[model samples]
Target: MHEKIFEGFCISSFILNKKLKVALTYNLKPEEENSFEYAMVSPLSKNSTTYNDTFAEWDTIETVNSIKSALELFHNVIMIEANEDAYEKFKKERPDIVFNFAECAYGISREGQIPAMLDMLRIPYTGSDPLTMMTCLDKARTKEILSYYGVPTAKFITAENLADIENHNLEYPLFIKPVGEGSGKGIFNNSFIQNKTELQQRLQQCLQTYNQPCIIEEYLPGREFTVAILGNDSETEVLPIIEINFSQLPSGILPVYSFEAKWIYDTRQNPLDIFTCPANIESSLQEKIKGIALKTYKILRCKDWSRIDIRLDSKGEPNIIEVNPLPGVLPDPSDNSCFPKAARAAGLSYEEMINKVLIAAAKRHKLI
Candidate 1:
């Protein structure tokens, strides 16, 4: 049986109202020598479409704005560009906390890059630790851990190249996605494959596009939902479940949440209309989703905050699709971002939600 309470850790809190100095961090992907665009926008390049955004696609200004909005209520917050120089600067300044949002620097060790730096500097930061970040980056590894703990996830196989796909006995109608990406980076309408021919084609595309291993899992063609978990491991709180309503999606497009649907600008093609918080599903199913999400969070050692994506099978049972350690917090009511929506459903204002994370971390040390 799973333990009801998290163990092996002691909680300590820092002094309250100490004028805590906080730093909000973001990353700039190193310019790709061969590709014309940065690493974040490379997928859109294939379609000959330029990915446009408010701050040139994941720029520091937008990231800082999001951080400032979230941290303003807690203490004096400073925004810093995540880099070697920035790390040095942060050490010199010595902030009380670092709001780490640096997903990656290049095509290299993306998530571990910044947390590793923070560790070397002995700086405290929000979100997952470097170990958790590294483990979660490789989707296959995360799934393996979950499965080892008997957590419910889809049958999946990972391959570094096309030759790897030939040896595995994976089920049909598989979902192909990059093994190490977030924000639905490489997922698209064609990501769901029905037969060997299409599977090989998608596999080749994934291998060429990501230049990394790909995870192919048996597709769960049913309702899609997301559950957000907050607080620390010992006292974590499960937020309301959110569902992706694909009823309005154009036929032929797989119900899978794709890059186009996630970041593309086209309204008709985007699937924003399909998202609903406190997902209108059966109470038993909601409880199941909550239970599975909490289990994944505990097994993965995810702390502070995390989001788990799930899908319901034809039998209405939930299957773990993916785990998001650092989810987006865009508060624009029109955007339909899951983190803030879940926060609102849990009775937190935008400012309160941001402060709550810091409070949770501070209270761990008795700071609050």
Candidate 2:
């Protein structure tokens, strides 16, 4: 049991020092067999605010279970479903810390809900705070904040209406994504627009699909990579960067990774070959990527851990695409979540990565 449990972990004083009650809170998606069918049958009335409110952002039951086990390895663990009843559970648990993975049920501020609530409860938790969560969820806001810090990011324009994009100065071959979504929501093959007609069509699709403003950014035509950062301040460390390699993808796949590429296609047989850890790049390039990632981390005031997506500009320079404070930690190895993949690349097992996040949060809260 010890060998299997601690395979990717080492005994640390942090765990040996003390054992405290830790709350593992997550919003696990319902695993109904007809979930998709139910969604398809639902009325798509324009006035219905529920339309597009709930996304695939919720965690899976297995993921929550795996996280619970990891937390239990070093501390007393209690499960808290992040929902209307969360307060009741919190009162009962009174945990020493909260390991948060609740992406929430819906809204532009979905990811911030739980963290914001925890703030009111005065309970310490893992990952970024409410303000940071909301800011990072809005892709345009993230770019603006990074740009203000002189961080390199692809030039972007937010379009509330088609007219907002009129007379835009951004170069052609732009990328279109919902301004306030994560997990590749609303990003499809047509996301990469090289012509005005494609741009107009894709923008309309994003606007109609998400019922939110879309961001039109001067697309980075070079390599794309995601870097994971853990720890706070001087202790912060950038995990091994994972490059999204598309060579194994079927022919005619879009140059840009979209929702279909991430969730629909690349199944068990082919699997998702998009991840290539310890990316092949010059040492100088690696250093440059890490430096920019750390700088962005500090500027954003992100705590615990985060996964930053970056792509190269035409000049082979790295630019921040989006910063994800609540990065997915899918437990299954077959799942192509980047944060866990990067942790695995750094020789940390999935269990270890999860616990490290908890420990980091604990340290940040001055707990044990």
Candidate 3:
């Protein structure tokens, strides 16, 4: 028995040490791109509120390099830009596994573009599958799934046109944002609509600007928290919870973590004291948040890792704001990225965090 157990352990160690080829697929932001160019090209170029958040969801070269560096520590790393040629690249190289976080720029199915290709090629990748990726990107579809599972989520309606907003009977002070965006794209202080006229105007603006359906959700009034989760079923680990302190935001700005708040105001030179890790909450509340976050992760079929945004309702119950299967990892402490921040709070270095995600995926693929 002892010899058999020892043999099994040795084989496991051998498999773990066999370095695999890792394709670091990403959508890199154009180095020279600026807000002026975005605004000039925007449909609402005449509107001053138009800011250059076009590449907001894409990763910087620094971020892609950082992830590549981390993976190189243990495996052979290959960089693949997620674009029209990405499918051919994957077909040619066919790495052992893909560390995919390609937020492709285009249609409602943008986020799932790379994943769908990988699926067709029968290649494994990190995070959720194509269906889950597309669903989570479409906030309305995500909310619908959550609601169907009896998960707590804010009441919301998708407005493709002004008539959709006009037909809604939901109460006022609602939050409006592009249904298929992440990294705070298309979200701003004015996203908070107080009355019918403002809602109609904002809805029209979003439709014309974003050229996509907008989800108008009944705004939750209590404190907000974002939970980062890692691993998979039965062994999934919830990292330290991070609370978004609205009080720390620039005064007079709405409490929402809009594009301006995330990218403009909170810079490395002058960072906003906005996040509180391991949020000062009762143990019961922590468990509640973790429970809901894990349930949401599983229900959405999120694999490897994900970050779920939760806010408290008037009754203080936690309601999921949105789900991020491909959570951002900026790799800089001062950048104030929530996933890395939460992982740091849980005592994980950025490199460790990245490797853990890869390991999870490799294990899932039975590659390790």
Q: Model 2: number of clashes?
A: 0
lDDT of 1 by residue, 1-368 (tens): 11111111212122353558888788644445542233444444567643322122243344357668657644687877776677687778788777777775554366777777877887777888877887887889999999999987889998887888887787788889889877767787788898999989988988887778899998897889988888995678898888887765666666767765665532323435767887888888888888999989889988788889998776778888888887777656566678888988877666666666776766654546
How do the predictions measure up, each by TM-score? 0.86, 0.90, 0.92
Cα TM-score of candidate 3: 0.92
Error of 1 at 118 (Å): 1.9
**How large an RMSD does model 1 have?**
6.7
- Model 1, clash count? 9
lDDT of 3 at 349: 75
Order of candidate numbers by TM-score, starting with the best: 3, 2, 1
The prediction achieving the highest lDDT against the true structure is 3
Badly placed stretches (over 4 Å) of model 2 are: 1-18, 32-54
> Candidate 3 lDDT, tens digit per residue, 264-356?
778777898999998999998899999999999999999999999999999999999999999999988998999999988988878778888
Which has the greatest TM-score? 3
* lDDT of predicted model 3: 0.86
Note the residue pairs that clash in candidate 3: none
Candidate 1 Cα deviation (angstroms), residue 299: 0.5
